[model samples]
Target chain A: MQQLNEQANIALKRTVIVAIFAAVAVVLSLVESLIPLNMGVPGAKLGLANIMVLTCLYFLRARDALMMVLLKTLLTAFIFGTFSSFLFSIMGALFSFVAMWFLLWVGRDKLSFIGISIVGGIAHNIGQLTAACIYFNTSKIFYYLPMLLIMGVLTGIAVGIAVRYLVPSLSKLSLFENFLG
Target chain B: MKRGDILLIGLVVVIALAFIIPRWFDRDSSEKNHNELRTAKITVDGKLFKEVELTQEEQTVEVENEHGLNILKIHDYGIEMIDADCPDKVCLSFGFVDRTGGTIICLPHKLMVEIQGPAEEDGIDATVK
Candidate 1:
């Protein structure tokens, strides 16, 4: 009976942490959009929300991270963007999540947060651009690939650095330490 | 740096080079014939919608698609997306394209406005190249 209660408590703690991270992800996405960090490329934003996503990935399970991604994308699109924007964000978020998860699993010892984030960023751009190309029915849109790739690297590095700093602090908290473990 | 970091750097460098090389060659060839007449081709859903001489009088071309509306303003030597109903307004933000191989695209509307030089013997448009 005691073991069952302890297990339930752990599950509840995990659920609360996931909810908190999802809310933080949504707020970060909203704030990033407001900044208008246009690098001369269409649909290019700073991707500040990625920092929160990476933190969730590092401190939580893959399913939890994915849940955060889905929640953030849907909420941000409904509140601040249109249907088309929703499509792009969903594609980008899913791609980034998959790439980051794969890299973290396979290269946990060989790669740092920065490297994984960079790959995630590049994958996000590829996913968004692919959707754009399909919608436009033209391959000429690939002309923008180079610009987007460059910006992805820059922003990915920024997000990675943020995660590196934040993860350590969050891990220090007893609630997160227990839940994450 | 770890082995993975080195590999990632190499991958980025190779991708960058791939994109830059073609653009470099294109610039060299286009610069040689700077006086070639330019034409603006507007395509919607991969079909040619209209062709306008860039050197002709200013005009506004309105395009309506299942997705949204886009208004293109053409000048004597350049073209710009003056207005668009797309949420991102990426086409409008592309500003003016006066060069021989410039383009403005509205992904939501599947609209493409590309500036091309005179038809080459190869029959390939500058943008496709």
Candidate 2:
């Protein structure tokens, strides 16, 4: 009975942490949207939510991270985006999650978090472009690829640096340690 | 940053440059062919909204639909999204697209403006001839 109770407590703590990460992601996206970082490239933004996603990926289980991504994507799409925006967000979020998860699994400690984040960022752009291409039914939309790639690399570096600092500090917290254990 | 991170960045930069350098050359070569006319085609929801020939006169086109409204300014040199009513206003940032393959897109409004050169490039040379 005591073991079951302890397991339930850990499960509850995990849910709370995931929820918190999702909330942070949504808020970051909201704040990011408010900032006019248009950069003359359509669909380009700072990708601030990536910081939260990367931090969650590092500190939590993959399942928890996936949950957080879904929460962030759905909530943000409903709150601050339209139907098309929802499509883009879901495609980008899923692609980024899969890429990051695969990198973590395959590379383990072999690859830096920054490298993985960069891949995630690029993958997110590709996914969004794919969604655009399908919706528009035109390959010409790919004309934006070169610019988007550069933007992805720049934002990826920023997100990676943020996660690098965030993960260490977050790991030291008792709540996270307890949940991990 | 790790060595791997540096390598990854280098690879992405190389790929981006590869895509961009060709387009730069294409734009330069196309500019030399002054006889070839360029046309800007704006589409909404994958349907033709309007098509304007690139000429000396500058004009402003206001596109109003149920989705949103976007104002496009067309000049002899290029087409630009001057204003938009969408939530993101990303279209306005597209600035100007002058080159043959250039484009400015407003995803929320399902609007896209594409610049097309004379049909010679697309194997439609018979029609041009």
Candidate 3:
């Protein structure tokens, strides 16, 4: 009974932490929105919120990672009134989670910026473009596929480097220690 | 860069070329096709709303829906979002759409711009949004 209670407490704590991260993600989402990259594309994003997601990953479980993503998506929609486009955001978030999680599994210890970022970037594009195709109801994804794929690689490299910069500091945090354990 | 780093750079260059070269070549053909005034479509939240014939000149369009303001620009044979109130200007930065396939989406606006050629089959998604 004691162990069950402890488990439930841990679960509750985990939920609260995830909620906090979701809030952080939302703040990061809006903050990043202000710092425009001017990358010369309509949808070109520096993918800023990725940093928060990566930070959460270092401080939470895979399930927590997934939850934070979904919560972030829904919340962003609610806040932005972009709920109608939730399908695209949901798909993109799911794709990014899978890619990031896979990198975590593969790198377990020696995670590289290039590999994870590459995967994350590719998955990001796939997620959005997939939603685009579904939204448009056409296989015309092929048209944007090439550019998006290239963009994925480039964006992955950038975000991967950012994550690499983050891992050392994040790993040192006591809050993150609970997550790692 | 050392031999290994040089090799990695070369590999990235190669992959980029594989994508960039094809797009560079196809750019012309797609541009040629887009020059004419062709019927284009707009969808909001998965519903087909309107189809407008696009001209080969710079035209500013204002689409006011419950979603938000959708600002469109048509230049030379391409159409894109010049501006939008959406937080993520992914649509505005998208730049242009060719006859092949392209989109400018303002999620906040619940607005989307899709271009399809009359002769171009399968470009239009059966489901609209």
Candidate 4:
């Protein structure tokens, strides 16, 4: 009976943490979209919400991180964007998640958070651009690829640095430690 | 920096440079042939909509489709999408295409504006086929 109670407590705590992360991701996405960082290019963004995703990936389970991504994408789209924007964002998030997961799994010791984040950024852009190409039915959209790549690298580095600082503090929290254990 | 960080940075730099260099050369040649841009073709849903001659007359072409409305401005130098109701506004950001072969596309509306060169060359190319 005691073990059952303990299991339920742990599950509740995990659910709470996941909800908190999802909320943070949504807020970050909203704030990032408010800034006019278009740089004369369409669909260019700072991707600040990626910080939360990276944090979740490193500290929480992969499934938890994916859940946060889905929540963030849907909520942000409903609040700040349109249906098309939601399509683009969901594609980007899925691609980013897959790339980050693959890199972290394969390069466990070989790559740092920054390297993985860069891969995530690149994958995100590729995913969005692929969707654009399919929708337009034209390959000329590739003209935007190089510029988006440059933007991705810069933003990825920024998000990675943020995660680097955030991870240590996050790991020290008793709640996270308890959940991990 | 770790080896991975160095490798990633190097890879990004190389890719950026590779794409930018060709575009830089293309821009130079296109600038030289600026006057070659004669007509602009607007297509919607893979069908021809309108063709505007790039002359000194500055006019606005309002395109309304199922998606929304787009305002295209045809100027002396070239043509551009001045405004669009599409969510992305990618077409508007394309600014102006003063060079032949340049295009502005709004994916949401399935609208495309492509600049064509002089009629003689286009006629010959069409006849050769």
Candidate 5:
């Protein structure tokens, strides 16, 4: 019974790990906001925090990717986005998470989080574009879609590589070991 | 190393496709709408006065009045103050905005000019929403 209690405590701690990554996501998001893309696409971003979310999906035991996405969406909305803006962000986050999850499932050990991250980025753009369509009620805005999608793939790769490097060392941490509990 | 991550990457690839497909319609929208829609809004002294539509057949400007006595013509890219009963036609100073989210404001005439884009787009089938 004591072993069972100890196992439960370990599980609880692992769950908290997902929140840690979510915190990392929030911090990275804030940092990226400062970077400010000069790119003409208006509101363009690299989405640096995606690395941490992807990493969370890989290293943690639980299905924490979904949780991380939820937390990031809620936190980022409260901090940087307007009430109306949250709808758009939710669209992006949900899409990106699903994309990342899909990549991980197919490739398994062969595909790195880098690949998954890249896919997520592309989805992120589509997600936002989708939100734009719903909000504006027209398809004309899609005139910008191709450029945004290409950008999404490239930026996803960039974030994914960063996650690739961060994951190994992060896994070494005791805190990380118990993160997904 | 999770299955979910693999699924996600596939989803992203599909999103890339979403952007690619739209190029088809944009080509038609731009090529076909030789006389694309022009959206405008006018304001006088920080007050909204009139919003007009200027078509693409050559170039021209129009002014509307509530009293029904005056009609103003605006030349190509030539947005100027029409004789408004207001104190000044300062709004006449700000010109046109054709691109997305473009706006022009006239302070004295209380005229504001805003060129709006297409009101709506077709449904988006990309991931998420």
Candidate 6:
């Protein structure tokens, strides 16, 4: 009976943390929209929400991180995007999540978190452009690839530095020690 | 930055430079040798829609079809997307394309406006669009 109660408590704690992170991801995306980056390339943003997603991935289980990404993408699209925008965000989120997860799994401690974030950022761009090319049925969309790749590398460095600072601070609090993966 | 992070960034920068430097040279060479008039080729869904010469006089080209509506303004030997009905409006953000080999693309509407030199012999498919 004690084991069962403890298991239930852990599950509830996990659920609450995931929900809070998802909300944070949504808010970060809203904040991102207010900043205009006129890079002369279409569909380029700072990927601010990625900070929260990366934090979730590091501290929580893979399933929890995936859940946060899905919730974030859905809420952002519903609030501030169209059907096509929704399609693009969903594709980017999935690609970033998969890349991050696979790198974390394969590299273990050999790879820095910053490197993983960079790959995720680039993967996100690739996924969005893939969606655009398929939708338009034209390969011309690749013209923007170089610009987007450079943007990804720069922004990935920013997000990765942020997460590096954030994880330690959150872990220091010890509020959810049992929940940390 | 960690060793791995530096390595990763180096690889990405190299790849980006590989793609960008050649295009920069292409644009520079195209601009120097071509003294004739330049034209803006607009394509929709990979098909040529209209080819307009870039002149001193400003002109507006309205592209409306099943996909969406895009308003292009041409003036001062350059072309810009003045307005668009597409949801993202990314094409408008491209500002202006004044040089040969420059391009403005609207993905939602499947529209592309590319500046080309007079001596360019390639047809639509040669553009790789």
Q: Which candidate gets the maximum TM-score versus the true structure?
A: 2
Docking class of 6: medium
- Looking at candidate 6, what is the lDDT of residue B111? 86
- TM value for model 3: 0.76
lDDT of 4 by residue, A123-174 (tens): 9988987876776566666777787888788888888888889888888987
Displacement of residue A142 (Cα, Å) in model 1 is 1.2
Candidate number with the higher lDDT (1 or 6): 6
Query: Which lDDT tens digits does candidate 6 get at residues A23-98?
Result: 9989988887777767656677788888888888888899999998999999998987777778988998999999
* 1 against 6, candidate with superior DockQ: 6
Clashes counted in candidate 5 amount to: 47
Enumerate the chain B TM-scores of all models.
0.67, 0.87, 0.70, 0.75, 0.38, 0.76
Considering lDDT, which of the candidate structures 5 and 6 is the better prediction for this target? Answer: 6
TM-score of each: 0.85, 0.94, 0.76, 0.86, 0.63, 0.86
Query: For residue B48, what is the lDDT in candidate 6?
Result: 86
Model 2: colliding residue pairs: none
Please list the residue runs of candidate 2 whose C-alpha ends up more than 4 Å from where it truly belongs after superposition.
A179-181, B124-129
Most lDDT-accurate candidate: 2
Give lDDT: candidate 3, residue A78. 85
lDDT per residue as tens, model 5, A1-181:
9999989987777678777878888998888777635554434578887887788777664366788888988998888665546787788888988877776776657666666676687778778768766654445446556556666666876887788788778878777665533
* Superior candidate under DockQ, 1 versus 3: 1
Q: What is the C-alpha lDDT profile of model 4 across B24-123, one tens digit per residue?
A: 7887876665555488888888778999888767998999978789999988668889988886566777887777667788767878887777675644
Ranking by DockQ: 2, 6, 4, 1, 3, 5
Candidate 2 lDDT, A87-128, residue by residue in tens: 987998999999999998887566687788888988898898
lDDT of 1 by residue, A1-181 (tens): 9999988987888788778887888888777756765577766677888888888888778998898889888888877777776897799889999999999989989988888888888889888878877876656667777877777777877887888898888988887866454
Clashing residue pairs for model 6: none
- Residues B22-70 of candidate 1: C-alpha lDDT, one tens digit per residue: 8877766665554556788999877899998775468888988787899
* DockQ of structure 6: 0.51
Candidate 6's displacement at residue A21, Å, is 1.2
Q: Write the per-residue lDDT of candidate 3 for residues A48-138, one digit (tens) a residue.
A: 6676676677667788888898999899878774554677778888898888887677664554555566657567767887777776565
